[model samples]
Target: MLVAVVLAVAATVGVVLFTRVATRPEPAARPTAPPPATAKVVRTDLVDRVEVDGTPGYGAATPLSGRKQGTLTWLPEPGKVVDRGQPLYAVDAVAVPLLIGSTPLYREIRADVPAGPDVRVLQENLVALGYAEAGPPDGKFDAGTGRALRKWQKAAGLPQSGVLAQGDALVLPAAVRVDRVTAQLGAAAEGELMEVTGTERLVTAELEKSRRDYAPAGAAVEVRLPDRRTAAGTVRSVATASAEEGETKLVVTVAFADPAAAPESGQVVVVLTGARRDQVLAVPVRALVALAEGGYAVEVLRDGGRSLVPVEPGMFASGLVEVTGPGLVEGAEVVVAS
Candidate 1:
């Protein structure tokens, strides 16, 4: 009877153990930890730059017109570099030299001509040509001026008339590169004989009204040439007039510091740096997260734990964004989406 009791008790114990095993819940599924990807906040220079397509060529071409009308006997070849006292073209089989001056020749300059700015221009050119020995560049036509004119005429193989008529010479702001000869060889030397540009090469870019601030006068820029070479350039001028287009556009002219290093004419890339900051806290743009509330935030990682910290984003450049905020410092690790 005791043995029977023992067997029954053992069976009861086994049933209780099975029931406990069935009722006990499986260990809670282990919580998963997200995969880690991070980047370090850095302090470096950040620049806000705009890259635009540019045309590398001699800047705007100015039309060249002659005051005298005659057969265009000879013309300078395209791409010719003409300087002061050099022949721009031949009119009536006589070379019409280019003189450095801003005043156009309007009337005849003779021994008894009235004092004016045009007289001053002629006197300056004569002095530059080694004819005037003593005297300031006065705007007066006197005996001394007549002597200089006679000498110039003699040297140029023209009659020693001691007089300069309109169209006797071409006046230009400076030396130029012949861009094109518009008139035929035998065409009349009247209007728009040719077009010329400054001797130095330049790049022209059209900036939309929104980007006008990107290229300010005197701002330095980088130009990438067609041959894959780079050159340093300066913003020469910003046009006040807007180009006619669907959008308002401003013309920006850039001149190379070393024009000889620039390509003659081709497509180029112009990079204008608007603003820059140095030694600023920055992080990869991917590290920034748009906060649900407002503004931006970066995940600050510390001791294997990440906490979103609000930040003020400044210039965004080169896949990096300038960041500033409380608890954000250089060398701090930040979480970035992989």
Candidate 2:
């Protein structure tokens, strides 16, 4: 009986040992995927751009009125480029030339005229035309002014009366391209005479008021032309007045650096580039992982092990996002989810 009992105890022990061996788990397999494809952190330049639809055409249309009323004998054709000394239109067979000045000719300009801004305008033009041989530009129209006026009149085939009528010349701030002529050859030169715009082509866009901060005067921009060509442009003007609709909107005008490269009139894309950073640390946007708490983080691979690193995300361009964090350096491997 003792022998039998000892044999039974040995059998029970053997069965327990066999069950433990069968239930034991195997060693974990080594990962073969290399911790999900990884990308290297790089230091490069980044530019954030906001693209908006824009119209490519003349900058702004300015109305040109006839200074004097008379029969329109001649008018510049639409699309004609009028320079400083060129005739913008003719009244009663008399050509009214264009002069560059901000001050309009409110009254007749002639010798013995009192010193005023208008007098200065005439004097400046006279000096520029080599007609004023007496002295520098001055507001007073003296005897030298008379000689210059008569010389200019003679050259322009006008009566050498040394007197400038209020409508004798069309004054503009700068040279312009004739956009439209309102009056016909035989029509009366009265009221609105024509329309003009800057010589260079520009792109105009209406930006939402909320996004007004995105575009400011002098901001650099990129224009994509109809031919798929890209051109550099600058924000020339931003209208303070907002158009009232469901949402307020502001007008933004961008002038192309190379006007000749711009299409005459068509729809284009205007990309407003924001602040740029050079030699900044950046990584693939996919590598970024949102932390459960609040900010963002990235999985950094170091010494065959991955560590969750907190990062401050910044401007994003292309597929890369700017990031800054502790121990984040160029050429650092970052794990990205497949």
Candidate 3:
């Protein structure tokens, strides 16, 4: 009977202990909160600018061919600036002067040649060179034209043939700078003679076809040179066709108002301005919070506490948004979601 009493007491103790352990109230559930990411509201100027890769060089190099079929006795050195009425190269020891015109002197321009646009080009050039007081009557090869030709030939130290030959002069649209000379002393001038470019320095950039309007003609821009210096530029031309053989990027040429402002060759950065906001309160665009009703608000942390302050957003630029509100001020901390 004593052993039975002891066993029964032990059994009752085990049951009470089990019930107490199971009935113990779980530790009161504690609320958990994570620290919010934050950023400071800043007051500054914001500019919406687009930067594109560019190359600084003399616009485009165009190949210059000689119409004269003879020995190349003279060629200009590379980088030489040749102007109107100047000798581009010598053919058969005869200097072929440069002329400003659109039409080439195809046929022999003599007093008997029929009146044509070529004659008009020759006559106008003679007038501009001061060889003649005025152009030929009705652009016809007349007695006045012969007198001007003889004067020009004499001034150039050439024989007074009184007749303009087919290879006597080279006509181009404007003044050019020699980029390269393919003809050597005594080489044949029947083919390519040299390559030339415009005298102005230009920055060429390949802009995507979709953003074609970003660089329209006459748009003002800033060019950051390879040396980190910046200069002012304007869009000179935007190619209507593709700039590459197998691409669709439009070629944009930006010209420096002063050609001397840019280097001859280097990589460049073209900054195009879109919009700007001056001295406005702004924050990282990610700092904005959407409201349940409508509009946007920012979770501002102040006095060791946080609250949502409604904000009116304005111009957005460079990953920042302009904000305006009664409570929004510079140096205020706002939450930005990572």
- Global CA lDDT computed for model 1: 0.88
lDDT of 2 by residue, 36-115 (tens): 79899999999777789999877678789886888999988899999877789888898899888989898898776778
TM-score of 2: 0.76
Task: Give candidate 1 regions above 4 Å deviation.
Answer: 1-34, 225-229, 240-248, 264-267
TM-scores for all predictions: 0.83, 0.76, 0.70
lDDT per prediction?
0.88, 0.86, 0.87
Model 2 lDDT on a 0 to 1 scale: 0.86
Better of 1 and 3 by TM-score: 1
In model 3, which range of ten residues has the least summed lDDT?
Answer: 131-140
Estimate the TM-score for candidate 3.
0.70
**Candidates, ranked, lDDT:** 1, 3, 2
Q: lDDT of model 3 at residue 311?
A: 93
lDDT of 2 at 234: 91
